[model samples]
Target: MKIFVLFAFAAFAVVVFSGRSEVSQANGRYSTGSIDAPTGVRSTVNLYATKVGVYWDTVRGATLYRIYRNTANDANTATDVGTSAGNYYFDLTAVAGQSYFYWVRAENSVTSSSFSEPASGRRANGNVFPGPFPPLDPPPSPSGNSVTAAKASLGKALFWDEQLSSTNTVACGTCHRPEAGGRDPRTLFGDLASRNPGPDGTPDTFDDIFGSPGVPKNNADGTYFDSPLFAYRPQVTKRRAPSYLNTGYSPNGLFWDGRATGEFRDPLTNEVLIAAGASLESQVLGPPVSDIEMAHGGRDWTQVAAKIAAVRPLMLAEDVPGSLRNWIGGRSYPELFEEAFGTPEVTPARIAMAIATHERQLFSDQTPLDRWGASIEQLTPQEMNGLSLFVNKRCIDCHTGSLLADNEFHNIGVRPQLEDRGRGAISNNPVDDGAFKTPTLRNVELRGPYMRNGQFQ
Candidate 1:
């Protein structure tokens, strides 16, 4: 009786299997009942000039993968871009300067799996779209006073012209020694003493003491006077000269105090020229007439213009390179002016414009750090350790961004508010009393005598 029961059960199992086989044969497809959900999906989106490239890891049973895109972090409104057989897709509609979010899912005839992790990317020039910062679309270009061959050549000539100064012995190059990373070579006063001008334009107050050291005090008529204490002491500068390297990249203001503001007013007529975005132009308008730096105190731009127009360009620049001399050497100031500005004119506006244009060319991006950042080379273990420490200590927080400078003001406890007014003089804010703009660290080792007062050595 037990054998008979087992035989009946075996016959029932055989009939069920036979029925399943017959059904599969009739359909001409073997159904594995239900397909397993595709797993381990991964995706990547890369920005390009004309398109965005997307790719993903292949799923085991996925016949195709569907790409979904979103402009924001929320994937709820994401739309399916398209499907790819091999786990990759190129999004041609990716717009430049727009941030995009993406995720992918595997799909087959039977079913589809959930989306993978989302990835974010932007389409822009890699040079300008450096990460850890926002995209710099319409990428950095020369300002309206941008550098041209003619303008730059004229500017280079003006930069070396000693006639631009009241002494006829001082030139822009006198302090901005090009070979010395465009900073002053002389100590000037061996840690001399000077002060920031107070609200009344006098540097005698307690708030002004921490600024640049003793600039040679000017006479009432704007001429250099023999110091009553020591006549042989070299004329002292109020502040250390900053390097011009990569200064062209600054968009807002120049100088330690940002006194060379963005407003580009013609020094002679006070008429607005570039209106805005002309910090370099505004900066060049200074020094040439600054009583202590390059000219007599009351010497206006008109006198400087006259002197520049009447004399030969770079007449006293004996150390000028032969290549530079050949490029702009032979032409007189008027002739060079004609080639640069369509007429033989040397207005204050033209002078500032030319000098600013030439300064735009003095950038240096070939340092070891720059090369490593660009992936052109690798850093040694020591350099890597230093860099790691720099980041770990959060030094990068302020000394960051494309130019490696925040360009904003910070106090950093460098001095007391009563010692240096710094940005406070400009903004009139008590919180900004001692706040100073963070300087760029690029090629910093070569441009020493650091700090606004040259106190860092």
Candidate 2:
């Protein structure tokens, strides 16, 4: 009896302990759940129709969020969308000018969990929320007057006309194309550098005026270029063109340095001698003459004599309204230059003036914040909150809008490895240090590779 009681007790103890172990195994070990928000997020945007803008809740550690938007509009409208790990939301909706309902799920590994819950949203009747920036002053009125239809068209013509260049190949549009976010990227914008010269060489301005009849004029016939043309070498131009999107808003002159290069500097002041020389207007005309960027024959304007003569005829006024009179090339330069600059009157100064004129009028103040602040409509709660954060954070101190830069230069921590002084080299002022021009953030989200060095993030 004693042996039986002892064996029974031992067996019972073993069974109880084993049962406990099995239960624990079923539940797994440690713990698992969702992460909390790492950054602050404005509430979802409620819009004018049934549309709402949906965004993720907690960023936490997740690298991506798979999103799906749907509506009664169509089957194609519903599909998978991916978020950029740290961003608040994805504009992955397919329904244009229509409302949508959306759902998002956060994921760490390729296989994470579902969204916290199905959140609904539809786009509102406005542009997306802009990045933080300052309240810009009202853009200057269309300078002089509203540019006429004829002028605007002419400007675009000269803008793309390669005859404007000394090479008879490049044009204003070569560097500053409206389609290229209004600026040119070397490899991106038709691979121009592979075909052109450096913008600053002296041989640049030697091309015969496309429509003007004369020897490519020297320092004498009111012409400016006469020197060795620099060859195209990317090692020198570390930074490429920024957009000309809203250039008229700039109170200062053109180019990153504020003063146009390639033109004569005051042998005395270096203050960009405009007296008998190019105003900012005239300076705009210099690039096409560059041997490296647009000039030819090793900067010898003398060698490129025929090309220069051909230029004079390009913008010559025609006696017949729609026909080419003097510059009997297959196309007409004057007619087009007339449309963009408010007149067909093409001259060195007028060409630049026309370009400057068109630059002044590229406005698109249609973002969500504009509704609450600048635009005629009102803003939703989230956008209003974003605006509050934008102002309170002092992003406005440097980035003012609709064209967001102050047009001044700052170091802003770019190309730190490069040697030599930056703005100081140009100004020779101790205060100028490494300052580069402040970039305007208009249409910024679309324009990436963020910094001056093309470091995309």
Candidate 3:
């Protein structure tokens, strides 16, 4: 009877242990139910201009969270921006003035749960964003100014036409001398004794000209002398003439002080003349009437256009390029006008437009620096070192962008004795005193007589 009891106990123990092992195999060694979705999802934008912060209540068994983003509120367009193990996620690609939508899903080894309710956030305003620089090709058209071969041809003829001046001697090409870095070679406006008499009739005063010595002197015949050997020393230019190369890219004001604004206004009427982005057109209209550059006092655009239309094209030019000659083909101004414009009518607006179009074509983006940017050629070690120094010295702060010009104003303490107030003269703000717009350095090597007053070598 004792032996029978021992055998029975052993059988019962084996059966119990085997049953425990089967239960473990049926359950699977390590497994859990699908992860629960994150709850209480919310988004917030921090002090960083371009960052969005996403947060959610932690799920019970979530090992990770997948963050999805969409520009719109719709879930169909959502894409996984990134993943995070924690409840909080930070997105760095957020932009100002744009709303962002985000949703999160709790994920683990077993499964990923459904996405949480969408959350939205937006960056603060006043965040100035950077724009693209100059493009590889010349801009076919600026905001308001369009370019055409016919218009450019007409502009080329007008640009070199001496009849635009009162004496039929000076042209746009006279002061903007193409051979001389697209600027006048003259040190003074015309000759010596061209200094503007201050309130006290002295050399330096607040009322003195910024960069111009004075308006050119008219001869006894009422015509301005192109060049004369003045017996007395002449007052040099208050500022050097800036080059026209690549100037088509300047979207705003022109000149050293930015007095010639981009706003196009009618000369006879005070109405806003052209469409927006017509700064170049506006600028071309200014120099022709200025007594110092191309015209005498009281010379209006009507007189200028009539003078041009009546005379033969480029009659006063010493040498015309073969292409330009072919363009004119011994045609009268009216005939050329008919080809350029639909009619034989030549208006001041048309003249300005044509000049601006031709000026836009004077692009100079083939420098060694530009070539290096294109990767067509490698920069020399010395040149690379020089560029590195340029950045290290903080010269790149204002001289930034593809044109190497920030197009913003700065006061670098270049005050002369006359103390030419630059942008302050335009804005009438005391803080803007002595501040000048940054000039482009695309072809700086070719444009020497540097600085606003041509002071530096």
Q: lDDT winner among the candidates?
A: 3
Give the alpha carbon lDDT tens digit for every residue of 251-337 in model 3: 657787776566666665657766555666777887677655556667788877888788989887876755466546677888766
Give each model's whole-structure lDDT. 0.59, 0.41, 0.60
How much is 332 displaced in model 2, in angstroms? 3.4
Q: Write the per-residue lDDT of candidate 2 for residues 1-457, one digit (tens) a residue.
A: 4333322221111111111111000001111354322221221343322223343333323445556666643324556664533223436344435555555554554345543434455444544345433223324433332333223333443555566555344566556544445555342322323222222232223210111011122332234454342122321133455666656555555555555532434332344433322223444554555533555433433323334334643343223222112112233455344323435544554555445444443443334333333222554444445445555656567766445467777776554422324566677786666567777665554343445434343
Candidate 1 residue lDDT tens string, 1-457: 4333322221111111111101000001112243223222322223345456565433433456678889987767898888765334567677766778888776657777666678776554333325432221121323467544456657777887777877676777667755555676664323333333433345444323222222354543545566543252334454567767567766658887787877788887788888666788889988877766666557788888888888877787786654345445366788778756769988999998888776765544324443344343455655655555656667679867545678888887755665667788888989888787788765454555667665554
Model 1 scores a TM of 0.64
Q: Estimate each model's TM-score.
A: 0.64, 0.48, 0.62
The per-prediction tally of clashing pairs is 4, 47, 4
Looking at model 2, residue 239 earns an lDDT score of 48
Question: Stretches of candidate 2 above 4 Å error?
Answer: 1-148, 185-236, 261-283, 297-331, 334-346, 375-393, 417-420
